[model samples]
Target: MSDIFRYIQKYQNRSLKELPFTHVDALIFAQLSYIDYRTIRNIYAKPKLKQIAHLLDLQEVEAGYLSGKDNRRLLLALAHAKRYQNIQLINETKIINEETCEQFHALTFAYKQMYYIVFEGTDTSILGWKEDLHMLVYPVVPAQQDGVRYLEQMLKHPFKKAIVVGHSKGGSIATYASLHVNKKVQRKIKAIYNFDGPALQSVESLEPIQNRYYKFVTQATFFGLFFENEENYRIVKSNERWLLQHNLYTWMIEDTNFIYLDQLDSRFYQINRKARDALLSLTHQERETFIVSLSEIFDDNQITDVAQLTNSWSQTSIMLLRSLTKVEKEKRDAIMKTVGLVVSEMLRR
Candidate 1:
C-alpha cells in the first residue's frame, strides 16, 4: 500500500499554495513533533525544514523513539520536499515529569502566514503508555492541560489563522484546547483535526466548533476506541493488523490525501466496544491501582519500551495476568475479566 513516504516523493515539488494544505500534511507535522530537534546543532536559530535535513543525524533518529519500522524516513522526506522547505518551525515545548508521569510535546510551524500547532502523540517509551493510561482514567491529565496552555501561548504570536492537529493522545489535547480557549481565540482557529485520539468528552460538549472538528481513525484502530467518542470519525485504510493500526505511519496514502474507508471492521468494533465498557466499569481507585500494577509489571519484566509491549501484546497479556493475581478478590474478577478481553483481542490478531 502506498503511504506518506511515497506521497512525499510524489508531491515534493508542490507548494502549499499550489495544492493547499490537507489533514495529511498536518499528520506529517504531528508525527514530526516527536523528533528531538534539540539534538540538532544551533537549534536556537529555529531553522527551516530544508536546513533540518542537512543538520539531522539519521543515526540518532534510528536510535530514538521514532525508530519504528520504516519510520526514520519521515524527516529526510520532509527535509528534501520543496513543498515544506520554507516551512519554519517557530516554537516547540516538550515536558516530561517523572513525578506526575506527564509526557507532553507541542510544536508550532509557520507557513504562508499560518500557524499549525501540533500536540504530539506519546513517544514509544514506557512512560508514553503510562501517560495514555493517565488520560484514560483522569478527568484531565496534566499533559492535556499543558497542551491547552501551550496553545494559548502560541496564539500570542503574530498569525492570521491557526490550525490545530494531533494524533493519539496529542489529538485529544488539540480538541480539548480548542474547546477551552475563549471564543475570541476560537474564532482565530481555522480547523482542528484529531487522528485516532481517545475522547476526553463527547464531541457534543464542544458543539461551538463542531463544524471545524474533523476526526480520523484507522480501520483496525485500538487506541482510538479506548474512551468514549460520541463524534463520528472518518476511517482510513491501514496496511497493519489490528492494534498496530494505531500507528498513523501504517495508514495508506493516495496523492495528497489519506485512503479513506467507509467503516471499521465489525469485529474490531465490537471487541473494543466491549473493552471500553469493561474499563469504564472500574472505579477511579481501581483504575489507579491497575496502573500502578502495570508499572510494577513492566519494571519486573525489564520492559522499557512501549513498542515492545505492543508488538508482543500476547506476551504482555500473560504478564498482566500475573500482575493482577494480588488484586482484592472482589476486584480481581472484574479486572481479570477485563484482562481476559484484552488478551482475547490480541489473540484475535
Candidate 2:
C-alpha cells in the first residue's frame, strides 16, 4: 500500500484547483506541521514553499529538529514537489507553557480559495506526553486554548472558507478550536479533518460545529478512540500494527484517497473501551495524583522522551516500583490494578 510520499509523486503535477483538496491532502499538511518551519524562514512572514525547500537543501541545522528519523527528509521533498509548492504559508506559531506542560503549534496556509489551519501533534518531550494524559480529566487544555486564539486570529484574514486539520493531539485541538470559535466564524468553516486524533472529553460544547467534523482512524487505533466520539468517523486500513498505527506515515493510501475499512478491529475497540472505562472509574483527584506520579518518575530518571523511558526497561521498572512506594496505598493499588487490566488485555491480543 502507498503512503503520502507516493501520493505526492503520483499527483505532484496536479494543482489543488485541478484535483481539489481531499482528506489525503489534509493528512499531508497535518503531518507537515511537525516540521520546525521557523528554522527555515520567519513564520510571521508569508514564505513560499520553495523557500522552505531551499533551507532543507542547505541542511540548515534546525530545519527538522523535532522531526523523527526520515520525516524531515520526506517533508523537504514534499515542499519542492509540484503539488505543494504553490501553497503559501500564512503564519505559524509554536508555544510551550512550562507550568501547564502544554505544547502547541498552529500553522495557517493559503491554498487556492481556501485557508487551512494545521495543529502540530506531540513531540519527543515528556511534557508533551504529560499534556496528552492531562486531557483525560480536563475538558480544556492550554493547547486547546491556544488553538481557539489562533483560529480566531486567522479568521480575521480575508478568505472564502477554512479547513481545520490535525493528526494525533493536534487533531483534538483542531476540533476544539472549531467548536469554540464564534458562530460567525463557524459559518465560514468548510470542514474539520481529525486524523488519528483523540476525541474530546466532553462534546457538550461541540454542538455548534458538530456536523462539520470528520474523523479518520486506523483499524488498530488507540489514541483516536481515547474519549467519546459523537461525530461520524471512518476506519481505515494501515500498514502498521498496534500503537505504531497512530503514525500517519503508516496509514495506507490508494491513488488520491485512503484505503477505507468497513470497521475497526474488534480487539482494538475492546482495549480502547476498557481503557477508557478504567480511567473514568477513577476520581478526579486520583487521576491527577496518578498522572503527577508518572510525570515525577520520568523526571526522577531524567527521561525526556518515551523511547528513553522505555529503552532501559530494567531501570524504568525499578524506578516505577520505587515511585509506587511513595504514593498512598489506595492510589497506588488503583493505578497498578488499572495497569494490570490494560496489560492483560494487550497480552490476550
Candidate 3:
C-alpha cells in the first residue's frame, strides 16, 4: 500500500487527479501514467467513429457514441486502443493506394509513441469501475475469440513489418491476436511484446498458436506471469522491486521508445505450462468468488478507498500467503489492506 502512495507522490506531476487516492483511483492513475500523452490526445481528436473504435479495441461500444460522452470512459477507451500501433517501414512507398500509404506513413515516422488516457468517474463513482466490469464479463473464457476480433478489425494496415505490444490484459490480447491472425497477416508481424498478462485457461486449445508470442514478467509479479496455466512465453527479469513489477514501471526505454527485455526461450514457455495447471486445479466457483470479492472493494466511495482499507500486499495475496486458512480471507484482506494504505497516505499528505 505504501508503494502506491510513494508512486503518487514521486510522480505528482504525472498524477492526473489531486484529491486523496482510493484503491481504484491508484490503479487507474498508475495506468494513465504509464501511457504516453500524445496517444491520449489522438483518441479524442480522431473524428471517425470506426477509427476511434479501432483505436480502442478492449472496450466495445457502438460507433455512434464517439462524440457523445466527452468523458474519461471514452477517453480511456481510446487510449487503450492506441497502444497496439507499432508499424515500421524501411523504405518510403508511394506505390500503395493513397489511403493505405497514408496510414503506413503515419506510424513509420515514430518508433514508439506514449499516450495517457484518463477517465475520472463522477464523484459518486470509483475510478475504472465501469471499465473493469466490462473486462470481467467473460471471465474464465479463452481471450482469443475477442483478441482475433480486435486484430482483424483494427489492424488492417499492410506494411513491411510491425511489432504489437501491451501490458497486463493488453498483453494477453496481443499474444492471442498475433498467433491467430491469417498466415499472410502473421508474416507481416515481425515481433510481439507482452508484459505480464495472465496465461490461457486451456493450453491444448492454444498449442498451435503459441510460437509467435513473446511475454515478459518480473520475478515477483503475482498476476500475469502466474495464474491460468503458467505463462509459456518468453519471460524477462526486471530490476524494479516486486510490488512495482507491473507495466506502470520496469519497462525501460531504448532509442527513446520502450525497450522490452529481449529474452524468450524454451524455459519461459515451460513455466507458463506449469502456471496453467496450477490455476486449473481451482474450481470455477472459486474464481468467480474471487472477482466478486475484488469488485466489492471497488464499491467504495472512491477508487482510493482500497489504499485506506489495509496495510498489506492485497486481499488476494493474504489468502495465498496464509494458505487460505479461512474461507473469508480474500474479502477481509481486501477491506483491511485498502483501508490501511489509504489512511496512511492521507496522513502523509
Candidate 4:
C-alpha cells in the first residue's frame, strides 16, 4: 500500500503549480503541524519549507539520531522535496489546557499565491483525548474556538485565496473555522479538507459554505463517523486495521491523489452507524458525566497515552474495573454498555 512517503518520492520534483495541490498534500501539512516548532523556533517563524528541512537535518545530525517512524522526518523530507521547498510558512500557534482538556495548533502556509491553514490532531496527552469526547455534546469546543480566532487572524494577512485542512480533532476545527469565519473571509476560502474528522453536532451555520467542504474517511473509521454528517464523503482505502485506519499515515495514496474507495465495507458501515446511534441516544449530561468519569479513571492510573495503558493492560484493566464499581449505578451501566459494544465490535472484526 502506497502512503504519503511514497507520494513524496513520486512527485517530489513537481511543484504545486505543475501538479496541483491534492488531499494528500493537505494531510501532509496537517500532520506536519504536530512537530514541536519550539525546537526550531528561530527559523520556523515565516520560514520556507526548505529552511525548516535544513533545521530538521541539523537537529538530527547534532543528536546523531532520527526516528524513522517520526512524523517530523516525513515532514522534513517533504519540505526538502522540490514540490514543497518553496512553500512559505507564515504563522503558527499552539494552545494547551490540561484542566479543560483542550489542545490546539494551527499553521499558516503560502504556496502558489494561496494560503493553507492546517490544524494539528490529537497528541499523546490525556487532555487531547478528552477534547475529542467533549465533541459528543458540546456544539463548539475550546479548540474550535481557537481555530476560528486563528483563521480570522490569518485573514488579516495579505492573501488572494485560502484552504483549510486537518485530521481527527483538528479536522473538526478546520470545518468549524471555515464555516464560522466572516463573509469577507469566507469569500477567500477555496476549500476545506477534513481527513477522517468527526462531524459537527449541528451544521446549520455550515449550510452556506457546505459546497466547499470535502470529507475523507477510511473503511473502518470510528472517529470520523461519530456525529451527523449530511455531506457526501469519499471512503478511502487504508493499510491499517480497524481504528488504526484513523492514522493519516496509514491512508493509501496513488501519485498525487488518495486511493479512493467507492464506499465503506458493509460490516464496518453497520458497526459505525450503530455506534453513532448509540452515542446520540445518550443525553448531553449523561455523556458529559461519562466522559469525565472515564477521564478521571484514566488519570487515577497515571495513564497519559493509549499505548501506556495498553502496555500494562492487565493492571489498567483491573484498575478500570475497580474504578467503575464506585460510580453511580445508572451512569456506570451506561458507560459499561457503551464500552462493551465497542469491545464486541472490535472482536467481531
Candidate 5:
C-alpha cells in the first residue's frame, strides 16, 4: 500500500518465474522482528536440516541443503541465492582463508532462490514495515567471542561489493570485520549498518572501522548508554514508533520509517564517569593480576562446600599476589573501596 512496500514487492516479485520455490516463505515472512535473532542462530548452528525442517514445519526436502550439520553454511548459501542474479551472500567464517572466500563468492547471486524452507501451515514469522520501506530481518542468536575471532570469519567471506548489516552483537561483529577485513575486501564494502549494537571497549582505537559505519538507536535505549565512548559515532534517526523503542516492540514503521532521538540521560553520563575513573586507577599489571585470580576461582576443583574449605587460599593468593608485590586481598579491598567511591560520585553527579 505504501511506496516502500510497493518497491519491495516489485523487487521481490520480479522474475518470479525464475525464482526458486524455496524462497516463498522467507519472502512472505520477511519483516524484521526481535524474535528472529535466536531462531536463525539455532538454525545456523544445528547440523541437521531435518531438525530445522521440524522446527519450521517444513519438509526436509524443502530446506536448501539436506545436511543441517552446518547451519551457517546453509543460511549463508540461502542468503547468496535469494537476491537478484548478480548479488551474492555468505555467512559465518571465524577465520579467513582462501577456501572461505571462494565458497562465499561461488554462492553469490543465489538470492533468486530460497535460503530457508518453512514447514507447511506454520506461520510464526512476523513482518513489519518501516516508513514505506519493507525490511526482511532474521535475528541471529547472540554469540560471545573472547575477542575478534568472529570478525575474522566474516572478513574472510569474499565479495566484490556488499552491504554489511546486523543487530546488536552482529552489528559489532560487522563493525570489527569491516575494520580488519582484507584490504581487497574492505575496499569492496558498500555500507556498514548496525542497529543498536553495543560499542567495543576499544572503539576509539579503531578509526578505520568508525568512519564507515552507520549506527541506529532508539531514544532512551539503555544500550546506547553502556558503551565506553560514542562521541565519534553517528546515530540513525526514526520517528516515534513503538517498535522503535529500545525493546523493538515499539517500532513504528510504514513506507518511510522514522528514527527518533532522546537526549542522552544524565544518569548514564554519571555511571560512565564512575566506571571510567575506577578503571583508570588500576595499572595494566594490576588488571592482569585481577583477571588471573578470577580465572583461578573459576577453574578451581572443589567438590562440595565442605571440601572447598580444604583448598588453599594461600596457594591462590600466592600466585595472584606474585603478579604484584602488593597483598592480593589488600589490593582487592582498595579496588572495591575505589568502586564504592566511584558509585557515590556518580550518584552525586
Candidate 6:
C-alpha cells in the first residue's frame, strides 16, 4: 500500500488553488512540525517553505527525530511541491523545562488567510513521556497552556480560518486548545485532525469541538488508546505490526487518503490499557509525587532525554535510588504502592 511519501510525489506539481488543501496535506504539515528546523536555520523570522526546502538536502536525516523513516524524503517533497511552496511557517517553539517537566514544540503554517497549527508529538525524552503521563491526571499541563496561548494569539490575526493538526501528544494538545479557545475562535477552526493521538481523560471534553474534530489511529494502536476515554476514533490499516504502527510512515495510504480499517487490533491494547488504567488510578497527591520523583531522578543525573540516561543506566539507577531516599516519608508509601502496581502489571502481562 502507498504511504504519505508517495502521496507527496503524486501531488507535488498541483497548486492549492487547483486542488484545495486536504486532510492529507494537514497530516503532512503536522508530521513536518517535528523537524528540528534550528539545525538548518535561525527561523525566528518565520521562513517560507522554499527556505526550509532548500536546506533539506544538507540535513542529516538520521539526526532527525523521524530517523529511519520517510519523513525527510516527504519533507523534501513538500519543499518541492507547488501546493505548499507559498506557505510560511510561523510561531515555531521548542521548549524543554526540567523544573516543569515540560517538552513542547509547535509550528504554524500561514497561507491562504488561514493558520494551520501543528503540534509536534513527543520526542525521545523520558520527560516527554512523563508529560504525557501528566495528561492522565492533570486538567492542564504546561504544554497545553502554551498551545492555547499560541492559538489565541494566532487567531487574533487576520486569518479568517484555521485548521489544527497534531500527531501523538500534540494531537491531544491540539484538541485541548481547540476545545478551550473562545467560541469566537472555535468558530474559525475549519477542522481538527488528530493522527493517532492519545485521548483526553474525558471524551465529553470534546463536546465543544466535536463537529470539527477527526481522529485516525492505526489498527494496532496502543498510544492512541492509552488513556480511558471513549473517543470515537477511526481505524486505519498499517503496514507495520503492534507498537510499530504508531509510526506515521507505516500508515498505509491510497490516493491521498489513509486505508481505513473496520476495527482495531485490540490484542496489544488490552493488557497495556490495564497497566495504564492502574497508573491513572493514582490519587491526585500521589500523581504529583509521581511526577516530582521522576523529575528529580532524571534532573539529578544531569540528563534530559532517554538516549542520555540509557547510555549510563548504572549511574542513572544510582541517582534514582539516592533521590528516592530523599522523598518525604508520606510519599514513600505512595511510591511503594505504585511499585506494587507495576509488579502486578508485569506478572499479568
Per-residue C-alpha lDDT of model 3 across residues 1-349, encoded as one tens digit per residue: 2332233334434322333322222233323322122343344543222233345433332231221222234344423332222211211111112211111011111223311111111111223223232233443222344445444544455543445554565555566666677777666655555566655433445544445455556555545755445445544445464434553434333321233445433443454444444433444555445455544444542334334334443553543434323335554454445445434433453
- In the range 1-349, model 4's lDDT, one tens digit per residue, is 5888888988899878789888888888877776666566674567788887676654553342112355656766876799988888887788888877789888888876699889988876778878887888788889998888888888876656889999888888998888888888888889998888888877565666778888899988888877755547888999987787887778898866888887777876766676676656667776776677778788776878766765654565455455556456665565556556666655566
- What would the TM-score be for candidate 6 when compared with the true structure? 0.84
Off by over 4 Å in 1: 41-44, 65-69, 201-204, 296-303, 307-315, 322-349
TM-score of each: 0.89, 0.88, 0.45, 0.87, 0.44, 0.84
Candidate 5, 230-287: lDDT as tens digits:
6544343333331223432233334334333455445544544554455445656666
lDDT of 1 at 323: 62
Candidate 3 achieves a global lDDT of 0.39
Question: Candidate 6 overall Cα lDDT vs. reference?
Answer: 0.75
Q: Rate the local accuracy (lDDT) of all candidates.
A: 0.79, 0.79, 0.39, 0.77, 0.37, 0.75
Q: Ten residues in a row with the worst lDDT in model 3? A: 100-109
The TM-score, computed over Cα atoms with residue i paired to residue i, of candidate 2 is 0.88
Query: What TM value does model 5 have?
Result: 0.44
Better TM-score candidate (3, 6): 6
* Candidates by TM-score, descending order: 1, 2, 4, 6, 3, 5
Candidate 6 collision pairs: none
Q: What is the number of backbone collisions in each predicted candidate, taken in the order shown?
A: 0, 0, 44, 0, 48, 0
State how far residue 101 of model 4 sits from its true place (Å).
2.2
Error of 3 at 300 (Å): 5.9
Error of 1 at 244 (Å): 1.3
Q: Provide the clash count, candidate 3.
A: 44
